[model samples]
Target: MDLNLRKAILSNIESNDQKQLEATIVEAIQNGEEKMLPGLGVLFELIWKQSDEQDKQEMINALEQGVKQETTG
Candidate 1:
């Protein structure tokens, strides 16, 4: 089967307003389904690609803190 996941997801969300996008992301995370991971990954890819160095560093720092919290707390 041929598939274009990223294209399809982008198309699906293209018209979404900020609230709609937030709801979609929140619902996906709250549901915690494995099937939703690819969509979340695509969203993360979009964020990463658009971020500048400082933004990327902040994201990395936040991720590091999250990992540390997970391990230590």
Candidate 2:
């Protein structure tokens, strides 16, 4: 069986509006199930693809800070 997980994730959310997208993300995160990780990865991939260099840098910076806090706190 051939499965395109990224395509499936995109298709599932293609019709969502901004609020719906926010809700989806928030709900998935709150649930914290391993199955939701792939969907979040797809969303992050889309965001990364669409981001400009500055935006990418900002995300990296935020991620670095988050990692540091997690490790040190």
Candidate 3:
């Protein structure tokens, strides 16, 4: 069986409002389940595709800082 995770995730959340989207994201992260990773990755992919160069750079910087914090803390 071939499953398109990105499509599935997008379809599921396509009609969500800001509050609903925030709740979904918060629930997924707070659940801390590995199954949610693909959904988060798809979300990130969407954000990356929509972001301008400066936004992308800021995201990279934040990721770098997060990685460093994880390693050092």
TM-scores for all predictions: 0.88, 0.93, 0.92
Give the higher-TM-score candidate: 1 or 3. 3
Q: What would the per-residue lDDT of candidate 3 be over residues 1-73, giving only the tens digit for each residue? A: 9988789999999999999988988999999999999998888898899999999999999999999998999
- Of 1 and 2, the candidate ahead on TM-score is 2
| Residues 1-73 of candidate 2: C-alpha lDDT, one tens digit per residue | 9999989999999999999999999999999999999999999998999999999999999999999998999
Please give the TM-score that candidate 2 achieves against the real structure. Answer: 0.93
Angstrom error at residue 25, model 3: 1.4
User: How far out, in Å, is residue 54 in model 1?
Assistant: 0.4
Candidate 3 clashes between residue pairs 3 or more apart in a chain or in different chains: none
Q: Which residue pairs in candidate 2 have backbone atoms (N, alpha carbon, C) closer than 3 angstroms, thus clashing?
A: none
Report how far residue 68 has shifted in candidate 3, in Å: 0.7
TM-score of 3: 0.92
**lDDT preference between candidates 2 and 3, better one:** 2
Q: How close to the true structure is residue 43 of candidate 3, measured as C-alpha lDDT?
A: 84
The local distance difference test score of each candidate is 0.95, 0.97, 0.94
Question: Which numbered prediction scores highest in TM-score against the true structure?
Answer: 2
Evaluate model 1: give its lDDT. Answer: 0.95
Count of residue pairs whose backbone atoms collide, per candidate: 0, 0, 0
